[model samples]
Structures are given as structure tokens and as C-alpha cells.
Target: MISRSVTARLMMPLAICMLMLCALAGVMIYAQLMVSSANRAALQGQENVTELGELRSVSRALQRDALNLINEPAGEARDTIAKKFDGRMEKFADGLKKLEGLDAHSFVPQDYFDSQHKVAQQLADVAVKANGGDQAGALEDFRGKVRPAEREASKVADERIEALGAEVEKLIASAESADRFAKILLLVATIVLAGAGLTAGFLITRRGVVIPLLGLQEAMGHLAAGRTSIAIPSIDREDEVGNMAQSMARFRDQLAAAEKAKEAQAELIVSSIGAGLGELASGNLEARVDAELTGVFAKLKADFNRAMEELQGTMQSVNRATTGINGGAAEIRQASSDLAERTERQAAGLEETAAALTQVTTGVKETAEGAQSASNAISVTQDQATEGRKVLTEAVTAMDDIQKSAQEIAQIINVIDGLSFQTNLLALNAGVEAARAGEAGKGFAVVASEVRALAQRSADAASDIKKLIQGSGELVNRGVNLVGQSGEAFTRIVDQVTEVSRLVKDITDQTNRQSTTLSQVNVAVREMDATTQQNAAMVEETNAAVSTLADEASRLEQMISQFKVGTRRDAPAPVAAPATVHTPAPRRSYRTQGALAVAAAPADDDWAEF
Candidate 1:
């Protein structure tokens, strides 16, 4: 807000100039728009003239076509002329429709199109009559009617062209008049705004910047010369100059106060503080300021007396602290010795633990190896059982084939026994027929008897074979059952062995993990053992440092006891100072090695494996 008041004076005229420029631009734009509109209208007028001229040309073309069509005889020539006339008619009609769509101010009118249409119709009628063999009548109508109508349309086109030219001239004149008026307006506005801007700038600069700044400058000069009584001007204004005036006023007030305070402090310091400093230099800490003062000097006097008294009390506190430090140093020495002994024992214990872990890790590794071996053996057993199962399956199939073959053999044997019996009956009948004959009958009877015996032997052999096959079939059936049962047993064994292999694999993996875990534990324990040994060495150094501290503490107590300091009102009964010890500044890097925890256990689930 303060800055805006200062800058608005500079910017106000520029804002007015911007507004005036906008107005000038608006006038220029309006002029330009009027000119563009006039130009477009002029161009439209020219197009209308062109359209009128074109229509005249089309009318002439249609007249020629009609004349040609009427003179032609009824043949290909007449038909050709008729086609040309029709095409011209269509072109003329299209022209009339296009002119109808023109703007209201366009030169083309309905009366013009109606006249052209009447001329085209008369020409068409002339052609039709001539083609119908009434050439004379058609010629008369062409001269009297169509020709007159065409002449009238040509006159109308000429008038329309003249009217368009006049309208275009009027539009151009109006645009020129507007442009001239806008130019004059812009010139006058520029001059008026320029004069106003200069006047406003001068007035604002004089009132807002020059007058206030001059007054402030004079006041500031007085302030620099230490004439702080002068009043700063323009502080009530909301401007940068006013803010500077206020700042100057504050600075003057502070300077006057500082001068007064400095003079007072000088007199007060000599009267009161000088003696206290002299006593302090002589190590007389009990001396302090008691004189009363005011303003900043009052605070100074209180601070000086308080400082001297605090120094006296601090010396007495140092004396008591030295005594306490001596006793604490003695305790630290004893504790250091005890800590060294414990550190040595801790190192020994860590070494033993590490050794035990190593043994356990080795055992776990061995167990893992055994489990792996068992897994391999189980896998091999599983494969062998699977092979035995396959063999038993094949054996059962072979037993089945044997039983089927035995039954087939029994059927063949029974057929053989029936054939033999039939042959024996035939032989008996032959023998009876031969006995009824003479010598020939005797020879036939001997042959029949031999044949009968052979048949009986064959039947007995077939019967024996059939009984043997029946017994073999029963044995084969029993063997098939036994082989099938063996195959099922072998399959079960394969499954059990597969399961055992998986169990053994799991055991091997678990044992391996245990071995790895124990190895890590062993390494950690060994590291801790080494670190503990280092800590023991550090503890020996700590004991030596503690002894030195005790001696320094005793010496400090003797030194503080020489100072003359006030006693405390709330003092406790003093403990007797121990042997003297001097303490040193704390070591920059005192490090303690925290013991690492090592997990020690037999493999998890080890006993459960049993």
C-alpha cells in the first residue's frame, strides 16, 4: 500500500494515455471496417454488371439457335438446331435462378428475368412452328415477337449495368468520407491527450514526490549533524517518502537516548564499577557494587554486583567439587580393576562357547551327509520296486495266456474222442457184413477187427489228454491269481519307497540348513571372543587412566583450598578429601564393544526323527 501511493503518480498519466490510445484504435478500426464493407459492396456491384452482360450474351445465343432451328427443314439439321436451342434455354433459366439469390441491393430484378423468359419462350415457339413445316409463319413471328422481346431484354440489361455502376460509386464516396472523418478525430485526440498527460505528470510529480522528498532531505541532514530536535516531515502520508520520514524520526529519538545514556553510564562507571574491577584484579571476589542507579545504568549496577558475588560463590563451589572428584576417582580406580578381571573371564567363556559350536556344526554336517545317502538309497529302492511290479504284471499276463491255451487243448481232445468212437462203430458193422459173405468176407472181417482196435486206442489217448488239460487249466488259473497279487504288493512297495525317499530328502535339507546355521553361529562366537580380548586390553589402560585421575583430583582440591571465597548458606557437611588426583579432558573417542549374542542349540526336531 505504501509503495502504490508513491508509484501511482508516475503511472496515472500512462493509464490515461493507454485509454486514449484505445479510443483512437477504436476509431481507426471503425474506419477500416467501413472501407472494407464499401470495397465488398463495390465488388458485388461489378459482379452484378458482369452477370447482366452474361445474360445479354446468353439471350443473343438463344436467338441465333432459334433462328437456325426455324430455317432448317425437318431432318437431322433441324433436330440439331432444336437441341442447341434447348441447351441455351436451360442455361438462361439457370442464370435467372442464380440472380434471384442475390442480396436485396443487387441490380438484377424480377422484371428483368420475366422479360428474358418471355423472349426465350417466343424464340422456342418460332422453332416449333418452323419444324412443323410452317416456316413462313414462324419467320414472321420471329421478326415481330421474339426479336422485339430480345431487344427489350438487352435494353433492360444495359439499364441494370448502369444502376450497379452508380451504386458502387456512391458506396466508395461514403467510405472515403468516413475515413477522412476518423483521421481527423485521431489527430485531435492525440493532441488533447498529450497535453493532458503532461499537465497531470507535472502536478503529481510536484505534489507527490518533489515537495515531500525536499522536506525529508532537510530533516535527514539535520539528523546526520546530531540536531535530533528537528521534526521529520511527511510521516502521515501513505508513501515511500513518508515511511522514510517515520524511520528517520525513530532514528533521531534513539540517537538522543543513546547520547544521554552514554553520558550517564560514563559517570556511573567511574564512581561505582572502577573500584569493583580493582578489587577483582587483586582477587578480592567478595567486593561488589551497592550504589543505586536508574535506567540502563540501574541494570548495569545490578549485573556488576551480581557478577562479583557469583564469582565468589563459584570459587567456593570449585573447592567443594575438587573434594568430591577425589573420592570419585578412588572409586573409579577400584571399579576399573574389577572390570578388567571380568573382561578376561568373559573372553575365556566366549572361546569355550565357540569351540563347542564348532563341534556341533561338524556333527550336523555329518548327519546331513548320512541323510543324503539314505535319500539316494531309498530312491534306488523305489526304482527297483517299480521294475519288479512291471515284471509281475507281465507274469500275470503270461499265466492268463497259458490258461486260455489249456482250455483250447481240452476242446480239441474231446472232438478227437468222438471221431474215434464213430470209426469204431463203422468197423463193427463192416465185420458183421463180411461174416455173412464167403472168403472175401473173411479178409474184410480181419481188416475190420484191426481198425476197431486202433479206434479204441485213439479214443483212450484223447480221453487222457482231455483230463490232463483240465488239470493244467486249473493250475494256470491259480497261478494267474498269485501273480496278480504279487504285482499289487510290488506296486505298494514302490509307493512306500517313494514316500520314504521324499521324507529322507526333507531330512537332508533340514540337516544342511542346521549345519549352515551352526557354522554362522560359530563364526560369530569366534569374532566375539576376539573382540572380548581386545576389550580386556582396553580395560587395563582404563585402570591406569583412573589412577592418574585420582592423583590429579587431590592436587586440584589443594589448589582450590587456597582461594578466598564466600561460604554457601545451604552447605552440607563435607566428606574428607581422598588422595589427590588430577582429571583430564574427556577422550575424544572412547569406544565400548558390545558383546554379540550367539545362538547355540542342537538341530531342531532332531530327537523327533526317531
Candidate 2:
């Protein structure tokens, strides 16, 4: 796999910037979750406060009702007292039951429970008295026993409800405090993370990218100035800069080798030429021009022979020496020109390598930015899920409270029905008494009958109310169950969402790592480019040097043109070789040790004859 690297020029800063962005995003998400939780908690607390208040009101109403029933007059006692007691008892019981269910979290204490139980017994005692035909006894019991007991129970319930209110207040305060703390923490985290990220970016730019490149620039300047011996630091980075440094070292090596080779060849040529001149001065013109004779000597001998034969011994030695020297000087000038051309070619190659490295650096930078963006997105998702969970929990709680309220309504309906039943019985008795009293009781008997009918209607109404409330309770129960299921499903969703967020975070983390690595690689490529550029420049210089040699060979041919070595006295005269001419060979042929370098020379090419 081709591992991604940070191009030294851009990697370090990009990484630091991305990391900081991720941290800031995390802090934002944290704050969002805290705020959401606080809002839900506050809303839930308010709901509890409202439900508690309703329960307290219901308790107070029941208490007042019991007292009013007890205070009724004798005639009213048999009618209103019994009727009211029945209706109120059912209402009180149903209300209490509903209150119990509504907010179990806000339940009245055990003391209240005990008190209410005594109140119920007193109520039952009054009913027994009335059923036994003791109207006065029932009235007395309601006034002396039931009312007082119910008042005590109401007091207990009031105290319990008050306590629940206090608890709700505390929860609200706690949620507010948590919200504040989360905000502060998020702020602090953001500041710290931002600072750290900036610092990291600066360091990366300064040390990892900028500084190294500067050093490389200096090294290159030195090399261009012909200071091949100047030493450069060996940065062992895995980035482009490191690669360039290594490449530069290799280029330096090749240059040094070429320099050495040129020097050695020059010295050998000079010595051989001097020796050949001595032989020519002594008049021994038949010395073989073989490989043993260096470049300088061979060219000198060839020039000397051409001059001596043409001048016909008049100024042979003097002229040959001067021409030989001139030829050697020309060859040196050609070598220099060749070196310059080679150097230019090497520079062009280095430029190409540098361009490639720059591209690598850009790619690494983009990757880092993408990673940071992904991390930020993940953090946001996590916060949303947290808030949703809190809301779901609150909804579940509210539904439970509503269910309890429905049950209380059912109880109140039952009590009303019971009261109506008692009223009907009393009316029936009054009707019977009027009928026994004859004509004087006729009007009273009609009133009694009307009372009976009203009681019957009231009873029917109460029964219908009870049925309605019971149906409501069933619906509420079903709703409660559904809410509970929904809450559970929300919980699961939150869990799954959290997991997905975590996975996104992990992906971002891995991307960050890869970005860092790519930065290093980019740096390496840049270094390689620099080195390759230097190497190519050196190759160009070598090619130029070769061209100079070819040019010098042409000049030697021109100097030798003064000779007519192969022109027979009876044959046509040979034309001097063209300065830049070349003759292509059809095939390659080998020569024996004592034989000439070329085979029987081409008759059409004069340069080949030499």
C-alpha cells in the first residue's frame, strides 16, 4: 500500500489545525447536551409541582365536604347529609387513589395513610348507623367521628404534599447547577484546545516544514556556486525534505566522481604529449600513435607530422611545437564548454522533481481538513442523542402521572353513585310514611315520589360517570404502557446513536493519523524531487563535457588537414575532412592488438583515414 505522508511544507500546520477543530466541536456538543438535559429536567419538575398542587386541592375539598355533612340539621341530615356523604366519600376515595397513582414520587407519608384509613372507618360507621334506622346516630357519628378524622388526614396530606414540593424544588436547583457547570467546563475546554492547536501548528510549520526547506535552499545555493564540499545536515525525516537531502548527497557524489575523472584524464594527456614532443624534436617521426599515448601526445604527434611533411623540413620542428600547443589548448576550452552544458541539463531535471513534491504536500493538507470536519460532525450527533434521551424520560414520567389522575376520577364517580343509592332509599321510606298518613300526607307523598325519581336519576348519572372514568383509566393505562415502551425504544435509539457517534469519532481519529503520516511522505517526495533535480543537472553537465570532446576532435582533424598522406602521385588529390562531418558504419568490426582502431578506412570519408 502506498502510505500517505505529510508534505513537510504543509503537513504539520494542517494536523494541528484539524485537532483543534475537533476539540472545539467536542466542547460544543457537550454544552448542547447539558442545556438540553437542564431544559427537560426543569419541565419535569414543573409537572410534578402542578400534580402535587392538584392532589392537595382534592384533599382539602374532601375535608370541607365531610365537615359540611356533619353540620347539617336533623331533617337535612336524613336527606342532604346522607346524600352528600355518599357522593363526597366516593369523590374523596377516587381522588386519593388517583393522587397516589399520579406521582408516586410525590406520595403522601405513612402518617397521612393511617389518618385517611381512620376517616374511612368513621364513614363506614355512619353508614351502618343510617342503615339500622338511627338517623340521629348517623348524624352524630358523622359530626363527631368522620369530620374530625378527615381533617386530621387532610393535614397529613397537606404536609406530605409540601414535602414533595420541596423535593421538586431541589431537583430543579440541581439541574440548573449542572447546566451551569457544563457551560463553564465547555468554555474552558474550548480555550485550552484552541491554544494547544495553534501552538502545535506553529511548531510544525517552523520546525518540520519551514526550517528544513530553508536549509535545503541554502544547500542548493552552495552547490550551484560550485561548493561541492559544503556539508549539509542529514535530516532523517520521512518527509519530502528528507528525500531531497538524500538525493542531494547522491548528486554531490556523482559530481565529485566526474570532477576526479576529468582531472586524472587531463594529467595523463599532458604528460604523454610532452614525451611525444621530445621524440619529435629528436627527429624520430615513426613513433606509433597508440592507446598508450595520452590524448595530448597523440594530437601533438599528428599535428607535428602534418606540419613537418607540408613544410618539407624548412621549419618542421619549430612550427610543429607551436601547432601542437595550440591544439592542446583548444581541447581544454572544449572540455569546459561541455561541462557547462551538462550542468544546465541537470538543473532542468531537478526542477521537474521539485514540482512533483509540491503536489504531494497539497494532498496531505486536504486530508487533514477533512478529518477535522468529520470529528466535529460526530461530536454534534452525540449531543443531540443525549438531549433526546432526557426528553423521552420526562415524557414517560408525565404519562405515569396522568394515568394516576384517571384512576382518581374513577373513584370519585363510584362515591357519587353510592350517595345517590342512599338518597333513593330515604325517598322511598318518606313515600311509604305519607301513604299510611292518608289524604293529609298526599302532598308529602308526591314530594317523596319526586325525590325518589331524582335520586334514581342521580344514581344513573353517577353510574354513567363511573363507567366513563373507568374507560378513561383503561385508556390511560394503555397510553402509559405505550409511553413506557416508547421511552425504552428511545433509550435504545440513544444507545445506538451514541455508538454511531463513537464510530465516527474513531474514523476521524484514524484519518488524522493518516494525515500526519501523509505529511511525512509528502516531505519525502519533495526531498526526492530536489535530489533528482540536482542529479539531472549533473547528467546534463556530463553530456556537455562529452560534446566538448567531440568538438575538439573536429579541430584536430582541421589541423591535420595540412597533410596529403594517402594521395598517390598518380591518383586524384584527397580533399581535407569536413569539420563537422560524420560517416555511418554499416556494422561493427573488431581489430587485432597490433591493428588500427578502424578497419580498412572508408575511401569517401577523409576523417576516417586518420
**TM-scores for candidates 1 onward, in order:** 0.40, 0.36
| Candidate 2 lDDT over residue span 1-610, tens digit each | 0122223233333355446546655555555455455545444544544554555454444444444443333574547656765776676677557556755534556666566667776766766666566767877877787668766765765565456545644544454455446434533443443344334434543465446645755664565455679775544655445555655555455445544555665455435433433443343333322345334444434543443232222122212322332343343234334433443443454354345444544665576577667667766766776677688778778877887887777777778788888889998999999999999999999999999999899888888888887787788788778877777766756655665565466556645654554455345435544554554454444344434433543453343333223332333433322233222323323231100001121223211111
Residue 329 in model 1: lDDT:
52
* Native-referenced Cα lDDT, model 1: 0.66
| Candidate with maximal TM-score | 1
| True-vs-predicted CA distance for residue 496, candidate 2, Å | 2.1
TM-score of 1: 0.40
TM-score of 2: 0.36
Model 1 agreement with the true structure over 374-443: per-residue lDDT tens digits: 9988888888888898889889888888888888888888889999999999999999999889787999
Per-candidate local distance difference test? 0.66, 0.52
